[model samples]
Target: MEAHTDIQTTQKGFRCTLCDVNLPNEPTVDAHVKGRKHQNLFRLRETRKRQVQNSVFVSGIKPNTLSTQLIEYFEQFGPVQDVIMDKEKGSYAIVEFEEQASTAAALHRTEHVMNGLKLRIKPRESKEFKVVLKKKQDGKNSQVNLDALSQELCRAASVNEQMLRVVESFQLNENERNGRELLVKLLQEVFMEFLPDCEIVPFGSTVNTFGVHSCDMDLFLDLEKTRTFQARSKTASEPTGEGQSEDGRSEDSILSDIDLTTATPAEVLELVAAVLRKCVPGVHKVQALPTARLPVVKFSHRNLNLHGDISIKNRLALRNTRFLQLCSELDSRLRPLVFTVRFWAKQKQLAGNPFGGGPLLNNYALTLMVMFFLQNRDPPVLPSVDQLKNMACEEEECVIEGWDCTFPSQPIAVPPSKNTEDLCTLLAAFFSFYATFDFSASVLRDKSFQRECADAEKYCRSLQYQRKSSKGKSWGLVRLFAPSCPTGAGAGGRQGQGEGKERHLELSLPFRLAALPDAVQRRLGTAGERFREQWFAMVRLAVETVFQEVLGCSPAQEEEFEGQMDTSTSSDAVAMDTAKEPEEVGGHDQTEGVAAPSGSSGGVVSPQAGQKRPFASAETSPVSPQEKRQKLCAAEDEEEDEGAEPAPSASWCWLQRHPVWAGRRKVRRDLLKARGVTGGGSAEASQPDGGGVEMELQVTRHITAKEPDPHDLVAFKVGAQVVGGSENTRAVLRFTPLCDQKGHFQDFFHFLEIFLPKTTEAFLGK
Candidate 1:
């Protein structure tokens, strides 16, 4: 009678109609619902549910006899359960156990078998179970399972053991095909030890289809679980955990700008990075790059032979991540083509010099070439980053996790192995198609883009940076540099160690506390030593995120897509708007502004007038329907191909068309010459022997709307001309300064995401 009563109570508490142990408030009995134990339980529940939903399941077989079987030997672990094998049409079964514990045991122990053959054992499942496991999805209406994803990829690769460890027996070496990825993964594992939840993702040619002999890793760092951890910790500390969350929601500045209670993703990432860098090793060059459209940091440890950047953002980071991720996917197929084209380029000696010439081939030049190659294909095997985002699933509609780590992918459908197509035709198609791809809309339609135009408008208002003491104009320069972007102008060669190009390479190195002036460096070194905990924490996160998630497509689409085709891009440029500021090419831009007076909607300018209009809605507007259809053209041209044009002979060459960057070359020249400089020539100062020259350089502190300065002259300040141009004395650093026409350049490497590279003085700060 007592046993019966216990069984009845268990049934009541177990919440399962078939269970009988309803022990009340007994932590021991309910311990399964807490800690990793609980997570393990949920995992089992989901696995079982998937099997049931897929119409396949486990069944009868005694313990000892069934260990080798799949989906059948589950009955050995507990009380006997009803095993109904329905071999009718579907490949499944239903095993209802007498106790809940037995079912859990079955899930943990089940072995499968079919037709005198052993299959992989999984637990019983049901439609209801799937619904339960999909709470995050049902709560919003999207289905993205990251774990199953990892499993699927593992199964696909057939890498039975845990993590992928390349066998040492083979003659191993970093090759164009896999060096960067292999390095990124090694870095990821090291950083992961420090940042359990942060992510490291690689994008661009390093992972793209068109990658060649020498390529750079386009990385992004991400943190999504940090917020949940913070919230939970707070809840655990406070009695009114739930109440405080709801009440504190309004305290967030973004609460006013957006309905979302979450504060800035940038801020959260900052905190998380600070927490992880403390535990990571060999992360010496760690530094922040907050101004990057995605707040980021770049670093390298020669000891480990790893160098990369980290974009610190929210879970939604996948949007931009997927952008590049998709591009990388496209590259997988485009790579063979890249190799072919590059071989042709080398044979033709068209790889431009590293100091900015077309004959010198850079990774960017190669990507452009490949883009042209595919656009010319019969069916265009790869879509532009803009177009591919359209096919990605929306964030609210899907939740992706562990996207940045590594995973096996589906093979792309390429032309027949021997399908020979001329490079010229492929080249033509790329130029025509990309030049006209509709960007403004394609970007917003990203699977995870939360199209809160109003909220974005508000956030734009709050972007204030620290102001400089110098009152001169401050220009906002935005640029993205990766091997994939145009690196050098001539044939694909670069100056080495002691050549003048060394200066540019120096400019490219990440920061070192010791590199600063004695005073500044001392302070930083002390700060690093004292705050070593926080410093390491931040560095570890920055490194982890760059390799974990920044380069990965979100699981909802990316993981699944990888199973098919990857399509991530290096960066997403949904340009922001900015207010007018003074014009000065060399002016120091201010990053500060008064908080706009409080109003209903939030913005950077704080709706100075009425929270209605902060600045003209410079938000990138969508294109027309007709144009959209034209964009969908099967044989469209490559809209933004940097190739297909002759290299300009002069810095002011564009003046024949627009003369945008041809600043006051004469006046600037006079200013420098008056100061004892030799050809300090700013046309603005010199009345052109032929005519007057004037070009307004828009300068502002906020980077949101900064227009690009004209291109810099390729000539050395001393103008050795043809003299000293040999290997002994050429330009040291040949990389184009990371700036853009719309003040847009995606430098995968940047200092604090802005300012000058301490190692390189091309920017004002140096």
Candidate 2:
């Protein structure tokens, strides 16, 4: 078979480097090579190559000279196709001709004149064509330079000064702010030309006082005046039966095509996207997300290296941005405290999903949480939202989308907060306050988040958190921002003195009955008094499936246990069982156990380990869903006496040979695209949490097939139990690695920390 440079063979398939896509076989590869999209991109690349070859870079042109003028002067040599001017400085322009000879002709000329000014013409610079991957503006890389940032923060004299350093390091600089402002002005001008009286208002993080570098620019397209203009134009045109008025001004064709007031949000967003794609210079990757919670037109500005979103009806967001600005103005300490807390949350992985949608908390939620904590302070460091509304005068009143968004337009109209706490103290207090907060009754109820707050609270009390390290070690805010480690594991590896010290990784999947589909919820409700046990059994099956089927871990041997086993008392698992209706009582009661294998090693447990029994076999005869549910329920009821503690538990032992976690994301994305799943769709392939169960299974298969077989990485035991008192139910998995010669277990455990719960939810939700 002939070989192609662009097509490379992998363990599972062939990949097209040009299109960045994977093909499963020779036929598919052939089809992909002949695809329209691929062919178009190939032609486009060729065109760019020709442009670089036949174009000349011209300088010394007048600053005010337009591209059309340059094109006219360059046309004397040959036919001119396009002219690209440096809009920022206007010092240079690139003019491309239809023929290669045109470049030589232009270079042959002794002098070129544009508006009677001599121009410098030279061959255009050539560069390689490489795909630039699109990156979200989320602050996922805030820790990328942690070592450098820590070194700087460690030099601070105190925690208060350290926090000030954080604000300085993360906040947007003047140049960035100016660039955003220029982009906004340009957008305003372009939109006005098409839709007269339309206003593009900047809001969100860019205008909000808490903005960080690289945060997205959120714009609200206010079309109220434009709608009115269209209405007036329609009335005027009715009498004349023409699109133009007496003054010779004609309604823009784009605006005449649709009535903004009557159009659907999707239609309006499509129009906005069209304008952004066709009219805006330096803008690309324009997409209309009409199905989002807040319909928006997403775009990227290449010159600014910025991503932005434009929405048609987001007046409330504008008001919220103003509110945040007012809060920052009222208290100078608020900005530093918010910034520090947000960074801490990002480090702890309690907030900030790179792709936007996930279970993780967002910056806005974290900021609001800080404000809520401040409002509860002894002196009340900040006013409540309702209080702010009350403070607004009659003329200052504002309403949007039937929501009372009233707030003083200026800080002078409101009184300053009476709280006088320092930034360090307030930051520590913020963690302390949320540590014991009853999340079940509040909207921030996520067990993992509360556990993180409690951990941060403990760290805040340590001497290292309060003062700088004299020995140049990580301390104060620096230590607080470090990635959290598992129990018995220090910053890098096992902390204790014993070489054989056992390390455990724990994760909890809370029973969110409300989040389940109605049919599933009704089925659980039908289970009545046994609902918790049934749900726990189902979760046990899902965990087994994830380990053996999805993650490609082999089943070793199932061990039968009669009593509750000792579990870790680490702070990470402190409140693992707590929830709203039925609160966790801080313990587990074991009933049964199942052993499963993990990794490529395919190792087996020793016969002397224990008696073996399978609760739900991952590899066996396929059973009907109803039969499987019945078997799980029957297993829970087996050997159970009346009035006994009803905790249905299972355990699994597995061997993992391959690092399935490595490159799992890329594999999953490729699999999703191969399956014709892209964008934000309802399918599991579009999910940020490792996609759906089947998709994840495919991803694991692809990864393991490609990954080299190494020695047994780690053999671990998984203990699953259902815990929660009356209302809240949760499934807790406890991981205990039998061996850790190379410390690969920690990495595996960390991946599971997020992957397990999310994938389990995906399974249960299905």
Candidate 3:
């Protein structure tokens, strides 16, 4: 009877219980629930429920109440999630429980007595959360929900799928894109009003389409048209009797006091900043970074919650941005790979600058490295920048800051890649390629000498007559990263350490010479020896070049130091320092002035004018820890000795966090103790401390004292293995750990596999 009286289940309207609102139809009800007000109320209801579900807000907590005591008391209710104390407001705290039932049970009592004081209990309030978009300072990171991303990646089907998922998660959403676009349009309109003919163009990640959700917007203030307009206006207003004002200025001109041509870059930037601060609505945090590599007016848009920079003379950044965009558009694989590598680098802590003001391999550098790899692959996956330039139309030809930046603007202009490899295989290959690459050299294969006309007439010409073509052919002539040729265990290796000499000979000896008939050996005699030496010299040069240059053991030495590039700055429009060459970390090659070849007795053994001079003390005898520290400190303190030959740069072997190298002293001690040697200074010294291994220890100890940088001491020397060559030469590995401690070494070594090459490259300022 009650059901019959009340039953109106088939009502025309639907209702929202949380908002306490009714609607006309189901669709209207759906719309109402999804509407802003309804959503807010729904959020509030959920937040309130969540706060009360598993948490009890205590109104009277003692200031001295320990988290341990809270846990002890709260355990009576149920397992505690966390206890958040509101210390500043009052002696209060919110004790969160693992179960809602426990929270409700605890609340049923409604009151409690502790420390002889009564306390009132309620539900904790949920704090509001907001997305904070911030500029990346040198050592700080903006807040990101990376844990959610990690979980998403964990659920991905494959590494390929994971990479794509990561990109999809981070890529700018439609709302963000629309926000940036609107801001760009508004800024452009304002700028055009001030300069009349100026065009505000977005570049960098913002326009590159590879932009992540919170990447900074880079705008190029194209004042070329404005400048042209200004020149014409000046010509037309040249004290004309009809249209000139009494001040001899154009009547329509607002820029009478500002001479666009004569104004310094800093002045222009300041002017831009002034205009933005005064006239542009929603634009704030206006600043002029005149001393920045690319002088720009940086600002934030209140409406968009976005940061941006406006530059007047950064054409290079524009070109670079276009190039990146083209690459992204051409290959679906490029962006995903870049995103994966970048995230991996960030995760492993290999990519952040340590606030000491040295270069880290930024996203730009990483992108270039990937491009180089693709261009170099067999049946190449991507065309060279030079090839792109060649395909560019006449109208597309561009020169910025004396560097040709010509490349096809459209992805369609680029020919499809011959490489049909899947994303998973390519990703695996990328890691594998870098793992074995020689970082001490350029990644580009050396331009091979080609005989344009291989005829009888050209046969008599000297090797010097075979000219190297004007730099780039397949790629852009300018190498993105050009490290020094690989020295390998050659010029970079330490020598004269007893058996080291024999190892060197073993490595350098020609295999052919060992098998030559005795009669032939006798007949050739000294000439044969010279021939063998020459062959070894050639082999060393060839091998080292292949390892260092082609393999990328070291990071490429950049042709010029561009200074610290602002992430917000456009890559194409950045004013390149074309004249200022990078000061090489390894300095000028010592072998440059050597007259003899590498394998000659005179050349290999003796010091040359520019070559690294072997230290008699270091080469002939072992260096004590004290002496080593003194030398390192002195070297670190002293300015670059411009006149003196550069010393051989110390090589580092990276290991993951393992007790292996750290346990060296213990291992040595144990070995000593096992030999029944105890309580003597000699016992410590007698622990199989081979020369190469001892040298590595000395290097680590000294460098550690000198730099005191955590990163510089990442790897330690545990032992050495003689990489035997021949009777004359050998290379030594001064830091080989005993074994992988579980998978710790493998996991750590994977990072090193990426890190060492990058470290070498970064040291060279590639």
TM-score of each: 0.29, 0.61, 0.44
Per residue, candidate 3 scores C-alpha lDDT tens digits across 259-358 of 8889998888878986786557777888999855357888888778777888898888888887888888888888887776565444333343433222
- Model 1, runs deviating above 4 Å: 1-196, 209-214, 237-278, 292-294, 314-333, 340-362, 379-766
**Total backbone collisions for each predicted model:** 165, 15, 46
Who is ahead in TM-score, 1 or 2? 2
Error of 3 at 405 (Å): 2.0
Instruction: For candidate 2, write residues 1-766 as lDDT tens digits.
Output: 3467779999999988988888888977876776677788788889889989899999997767877688778888999987877755678889999999999999999887767798888999998777665555534464457777888998899989998999999899999999999999999999998888899999999989888888999999999988888888877744444787444567788898998878998998998987787568798889999866578999999988889999988888888898899999988888898888888877666788787655568999998988889889998988888888888889988888788888888888778877778888888788789888866434444456666676677778888888777788888887778765443222222232221122234577888897678887898887655677657656776676677777877554323221212234322222222222332332333333333222211111212224232222434322323212212221123343444454556566676878888767767767767777765555665566455777777777787777465566666667666666546677767666654444676678767867887787777787
| Residue 130 in candidate 1, Cα distance off native in Å | 63
Q: Which residue runs of candidate 2 sit more than 4 Å off their true CA positions?
A: 1-5, 8-129, 134-144, 237-250, 261-281, 285-293, 355-359, 440-447, 470-473, 485-646, 650-719, 724-729, 733-766
lDDT of each: 0.32, 0.72, 0.50
Q: Which ten residues in a row have the lowest lDDT in candidate 2?
A: 600-609
